[model samples]
Target chain A: MKKISILALACMLAACAHYSLAPEGAHTVQGMSFVSTTDWNKSSLRSGAKSEVWTKDGERLNQLTFIGGIKDGQTIFTSRSKELPMPEFRANMLPNELMELVVTSLKNSSGGELVIDATNLRPQRLQGSIGFRFDMSYYDSNGLARRADCIMVKKDDRLNLIIFSAAGMHYYPKEAAEVDSIFSSLQL
Target chain B: MRLLLSLLLLFASLASVAEGAQRFEPTLPPGYAPDKSTDEGGLWYQVERFEEQLQTSPHIIRNTALTEYLEELVCQLAGDYCGSIRVYLVKNPHFNASMYPNGMMHVHTGLLLRVANADELGAVLGHELAHYLRSHSIDQWRNAKKSLGIAAFIDIGLAALHEDLHGLARDVATVGLMRYNREQESEADAYGVQIIATHGYDPAASVSLWKYIEAERGADKSKDTSSIFFATHPKVENRIARLKQHIKRYGKNPKTDETDLDEFQNLVVAEYEGLMDEQIALQEYEQTAEMIDRHAAIGYPDSLIKFYRAELHRQRKKFGDERAAIDLYRKAATFERTAARSHRELGYLYIKHGLNDAAKDAFESYLEITPNADDREMINFYLETLR
Candidate 1:
C-alpha cells in the first residue's frame, strides 16, 4: 500500500478528463490518439443497442470499448511475467483476439448474480497495451458481482487498459459509476 | 419517561460510535456482532460499538432461509450430542468459523458456501462449539493481551471480522474460534467425530470436510496457503494429519443417508455454485494460489485451475491478457448461464475499449438478468454517458 498524498489524489482526479495528443509522455505509448466515434463499432450484441469500438488502423485489432472502468494504481494489474514469458502458447494466434480473449475470460468467469442497473457500471484500465479501461460486475458467482465499465487508448494500434472486479458488496462502493463517467467522457 | 429517555440516550450513543479502541470494523460498510453481549477479549467497549452497529443489519449472512436450517441443525445436534452448540450464520466468504467465550458460535458464509455436505458442515459447526466448551477466544485474548496483533485491530475489510487479523502477522483472533488453536481444534475434531457419530451423521465426513477445504486451497495458484492456515497454526501438516489419523479411530463407520440432508442441501444449494464462483471473482493472487494447493492436496475437482490461469491473464495488463480474461469469463459465464455478473463483465469489456454502444448493451443486458444489483448508480451513470 502506497501513501497517496492529497496532492496525488487530486492529480489523478484532475487527469481524469485531461488527455494529451498522440505521443503523450513517458507513461503513455507513442503515436496514440483517441478514435473518433464514427470509426467505432456499434454492436447490437449489447442488450439490443449499439456499442462503439475504437481500434487500430480502423480495424477491431486491439479495440477500446466501454461500459465503465475500474482503476487502482496498486491492485488492478496482475503479474505479467508469466504472460510475456509464455510466447509459445500464443505463437499461432493474432495478437488482438489473443488479448481480448484473455481479458474477456478473466471478467466473465467469476460467478455471481448478473445485475444490470442502469448505473451498475465500473471503469478500469487495460494493461500496457495503451490506455483502456474495462467493466465487469462486482463479485458474481465465479465472485460476488460488479458491473463492468472499461476505458482504453489506441496507440500504434495497441490497447492499454485498467480493469476492475470487486466484491460488489465491498469493491463497488469505492469506485463504480463515478469511474464510468470519468472513463466514457474522458478526452484523453 | 425516565427509563425511556435513558434507553434513547443509550441508543444514540451506540449508533454514533466512531472508530474506537474496542470496536472492530468489518471491511466495506456492512458489519456483524456476536449474540452474547459479554466479550472475554477485554475489549468490551469495542464489543459495545459492535452491538450498536449490529442493530441495522441484524445478521449480515444472506440466504436467510438456509442459515436458519443450519442453525436448527446445530441446535438439534447440540441438544442430542454432547458437543453440539449454537450456530450464527455469517455473510462473509473468508474461510473462518469461531466460538466466543460464551457458547454462541459465528460461522462465516464462506464456510457455508464451501462446505459440501450437511455432515461436513456439522463438523465445522461442531469444531467451533468445542471452542466454547474449551473457551478459546477469551484464553487467547488474555495470553496475547497488549500485543501488536490486538493493537493493529484497525477497522478494515469485513466490519465484524478484521481482515488485518487474516494475515499471519495479525493472529489476533485464533482462526475464527475453533480453527484457531491446534489443541483446541484437535480436541474439537475428535469430539465432533463422536458427536457426528451419535447424531447418525458419518464421522468420517469430518476428515473429508477439511480435505475439501485443503483441496480447494491446492487448486488456487495465487494464494499463500502457509499464511491462510499454516501461519496461524504452528504445526500445520500435523493438525490436518492428526485429523486424518484420528478420524480412522472409529473404524468402518456406517454411512448416513444424504437424502434426509436434502432439505439442508436445498437450503444451501443456491449459494453453493454461486459461492464457489463468487470466491473465484474475489481471486487474490494468494487466494488463487492457496485454493490450487488445497484442491491438489486433497484431490478435489481441479476445475478451478482454469480460473486461476484466466486470473493470471487478468493480472497481466497487456492487451493479450485482457483479451484472454474476457474469453475465459465468457466460457465461465456460459457454463454458469445464470451468472449475470459474467455477462455484465462482457458488457464492461465492450465499454472499456471505446465501445459505448457495446457498453450500454452489456450494462442493459446485465440489468435484465440479475435479481438484484447494488451498482444502480454506476449502471445509470454509464447509460447517461452513452446518451
Candidate 2:
C-alpha cells in the first residue's frame, strides 16, 4: 500500500508538472519576446549567480531568433523544437522600448506574482552579452519539483538570438560559467 | 484718511488683476512666467520638467521629420490658437492621446488610425489644450500634495504624474487634483467646438468623431485601453451626447469647407496598415485570447464561438491540441483568411514531433494554396526527404 501511495504521489506530481513535450526549439513562432527583466527587478528577477533560473521538469515556451526578432532569420535550439510565441515588433519600436517590455512585463501584469533571485544572470544591454545561468524551482499543480538554467544570447540584428537551456539540476551547475564566458567572448 | 486711500487702492488693483488674467495666453512660451497675481508660471514649470523626462523615456520617438510634419499640419488647421504646445508621436499600438501640465502632448500612433480626419484630430488636440490652459493636472497635483514639502512634493509629484501615473491609476485616483477633473474636460470640449467652427471645419464633426471611435473599439485588437479610458472618464456617451445638444441649441451655420481626410490618411497610409498587420499577427496568442474576452464582453458569433472552448484546451495542451490547432487551421484555411501561414506551421509541427507522414500531408495541403510562398523551399525539401 505504501509503495502504491508513493507511485500515486509521483504520478500526481508528474501530472501537475506536465510540460509540453513538443521538443526544444521545434515549434517556431515567428517573432520572439526577449530581454526579460526590468530595471525595477521587483520580482528578484535580476539577482546573484546562485539564483534559480528554472525549476526542474518545468517547461519554458521560448524561441531563439538568429538575427532580428521573430520576423528575422533562423532560430537555434537543442534536440527538441518548439515554436516561439511571436510578438508585436513595431517598426517604430526601438531596442530600448522592447527591452522595457521584457523587464516590466510582470510588473504590468495583474497576476504577476512570481519573483526569482537572478542577479548576474539578468539580461545586459550590450550585444554579445554573456549567456545567463540560474537555477529556478517552479510550483507545479500537483507539487512536483524541477530545476534548470537557460542560457540566452543576442547574436546580431540579422541572424543573432541564440539560446541554450537545460535541466538546471546538473547542467546549470557544471557549465553555466563557461557558457557565460563563451557568450561574452562572442563578437558575432 | 489712510482707510479711504487703502479702500480706493484695493478696488483699482482688483480691476487690473481681472484684466491681466484675461490677457494671459493659455498657451505660454517655454520660459514665460505668469505675473504673480495670474499664477500661470507654475504650470509652465511643471510642463518643462515633464518634457525633459519624457525625452529620455522609451515612449518618446524623436523623429524630427515626423514632428515637423505634424506641426505643419496642426498649424495649417489651428494656426492662431495653436500654442507652443508640441506633440510626441509615440509608437505604441494601444490607442491613447494625452497632454501634460506644460505644453507637451504625446499622441500614440494608434490614435491616428482611429480618427476619421484632421478635424477629428483637432478635437482631441483642443481637449488637450483645454487641460493645459485650465491647469487641471497641475492644480490636481498641487491640491493632492498640499501637506508635503512643496519642493519635494513637486519633485515626487511630477515623477508620479509623468512616470508613475499608470502605476498609480490602480491606487491613487484622487491625488493632485487628478481626481474627477471632468469640469476641465467639459471646458476643453466647449472650447474645441468653437475653435473647430471658427477654423472653418464643421463643429458637428466632434460627434461623428466619437461615434467612429466607439465603433472601432469593437474592432480593436486589445480593447484594454478603450475600457480603461472610458472607466476613468466615465459616461463618455453622455459627453458626446451633450456636445450634440450644444450644437443643436447654438447651431452655427454649417461650413461648406471639407475637412481634409485625404491628406490625413496620406501621412500613415501604407506604413500604418503594415504596422497594424504586424500588431494583429504578432499578437496571435493574444488574438486567440481575445476571442474568449469577446464572448465575455459581448456575445460571440457562431463560427468563432466553438474555437473558444477548443483554444483554451489547446493552450493547456490537452486533448491533442496540436491536432486541434491543425483542425482549426484546416477550417480556417477554407475561408478568406489572413493567417495562410498557419498551414505551413501545422506541417512543421507534425515533422518536428516525429510524425513525418502527418507532416507530409500538411506540407502537400499548403503547397496546393501558396503560389509564392516564402517557405516554399523548406516545405518542398521536407516533402522530398520523406519520399
Candidate 1 residue lDDT tens string, A121-188: 23333334323233443223222234444444434333334333344453455445434443443443
User: How do the residues B216-287 of candidate 2 rate in per-residue lDDT, one tens digit apiece?
Assistant: 544445543424456556356767876675455336545454435456645544244333432332233443
TM-score of model 2's chain A, to 2 decimals? 0.33
For residues A34-104, could you state the per-residue lDDT of candidate 2 as single tens digits?
A: 33211111121211221212222233321111222322322221112112222222322222223322322
Runs in model 2 deviating more than 4 A are A1-51, A54-188, B1-43, B56-58, B64-69, B81-83, B145-152, B158-180, B213-228, B249-259, B277-387
Summing lDDT over every window of 10 consecutive residues in candidate 2 chain A, give the lowest-scoring window. A38-47
Residue B118 of candidate 1: its Cα lDDT?
77
lDDT (10s digit) by residue, model 1, range B207-237: 6766665665555555444444455553545
Model 2 deviation from native, Cα RMSD in Å: 16.5
CA lDDT, candidate 2, residue A102: 31
